[model samples]
Target: MKRFSFIALAKLPIGLQWAVLAGGGGLAGYALHQTGLPAALLLGPLAVAICMGVAGTRIRVPRLMFRSGQGIVGLMVAKSVTLGVLLALSEDWYLMLLVTAITLLISAGVGLGLACFSSIPADASAWGTAPGAASAMIAMAEENGSDGRLVACMQYVRVVCVVMLGAWISHLFVGAGDTHLPPIAAELPFTWIGLGMSLAIAFLGALSGNLLPAGALLTTVILGSALQLTGWLDITLNGTLVTLAYGVIGSYIGLRFDRATVKHVARLIPVIVAANVVLILLCSALAWPLSYLFGKDFLSVFLATSPGGLDAMAIIAVETGSDASFVVALQTLRLIGVVLTGSFCAHLIMKWNARVSR
Candidate 1:
């Protein structure tokens, strides 16, 4: 009977699929606000994700969800990058590099700690689950013969941690009441054009099949923003759309953890938990000092240091009064940097660690 109901639930249409995500997210957001825990906003998506995984695994749906979600996320990321961020580079490339390097070290430390404590191999575990860039990390891990299951586990674990922790931390500082919808109502006329352009860019980006980290969102957003900047498109990124995307991405990420994977590593839960704690602590420690040096708040610094999904961090940035532009800018830059340098770093680290172990 339980299985029957589960399967039945899984067969819902894509429209209904989105409804479930939105409804659940709103409810979660409301509850978090009531409790004065802004970051607890992730709870809704987390629950939805677990459900999506349980249901999605058993049923077939339009692959559109996966593709569209990817497209929108990538475009959003790409669009968010602007002349301002590029300008930041000219003023202080060294600071950006320093921050990026610190984050890499922290991300690496998480990978190393996981390998030492878990049954996972150092190289596989390290590259498989590093939180900085999922696409890059997964690719590198596969290239290097890392255990896929372990890599997936590590990646998802970090995702969960960052999502949950970021929300929690944000709520602690930014009052929950302040977490209402975006200023969409005030910018209604502007939004129509924005939506049109966003959709066009999203579709085109998806069709292009680029697999860069946050590829779809990055692509669409860039194209859309360019259109907007150039007066070619009149689009508005209302709060509703942002929230919708956030929930969708979070749910998609959460639903990816299937039963087989969970069962396979049930015993390693403690290690995953430990690794999460260590990584969070290490990132916080590193971010705190940098925050002081940069004259920014700790949360912004922490978000920059966070090895979670770029989308999630950006969302947190918007909610927590962090310099959303700066966070997005640096995070994107670091992601590109990670894509370029991560494999080499992993290679050297794995080799050195292997030599020491032997």
Candidate 2:
């Protein structure tokens, strides 16, 4: 079995190989999802990333793993923009605007905290640790002088913590009506053509060779979701695919934490962990008030407060049986908010850093 798996992995293109590993693990995860695996989502991505790290150390693959999983995020964001979701929010624009502002402020605060407390050079830590998109934050960190290792570690560690914690928090605060999330819709009976086409579009998106700075997974996620929404194509991304996405993302993150940064991480784990805890607590507290003000339920506030990316948060929202429309609505608004304000805040942190340096 090991030999066969190795041979299978060796025969595939580098990109597909990574995808298979990630996606394959996701599938395996899906199979066992019912068992309530701890950190089920992260397992696949970590596995693939570890494999890729081993392989890349041995032989380089140009834009292999990076491009393959990058687009998954964008595809996830597009899922939040169905016509119904758009129209409903159009009527509630004022409340969304408020929530967006609040979310941005909290994100900025957390970024600033990381800058001040950790040994991470302030600017890169601030931007790279920004908790929206890993690739986007890392790119911004690089451009802004953030340590990629610090930024990647901080961003992903927070993601892992936030997802697990968010769910626990939801359960914590759910009150009487809070219920465990329904099972994900099982993979629609398989069709080779459909699967091929779904992957084909993702591959084509990668082939576009555009450097979508935020990340290709997000780009492809957006494109693929758009296609799905428009009825031009349909994909029931199986657990394997989903797990693969998580694993690629997770492993990419773990690999980013080479020895030096790992050391920093160990020393600063308490600080980073505290930051995540504080952010989550504050966000959840803020969510309650906002939910009342917006005339939405607490879960909506929870979704808003939950700092996972639009895609990851959205999936959790859906998985936990939160109102899909509300989840999508809140996440979409937050995504737009982050894109517009994240850089400005990073700049602000940088300016502050320079002042301190002087």
Tens-place lDDT per residue, model 1, 94-130, is 7878877777777777677656656767777667545
TM-score against native, each model: 0.83, 0.70
Cα lDDT tens digits, model 2, 228-272, are 778886564455565455555555554554445556567777777
lDDT of each: 0.65, 0.59
List candidate 1 stretches off by more than 4 Å. Answer: 1-26, 33-42, 51-89, 188-191, 207-209, 238-240
Range of the 10 consecutive residues with the lowest summed lDDT in candidate 2: 176-185
Return the TM-score for candidate 1, rounded to 2 decimals: 0.83
Can you give the lDDT of residue 80 in candidate 1?
45
Q: What's model 1's lDDT at 59?
A: 28
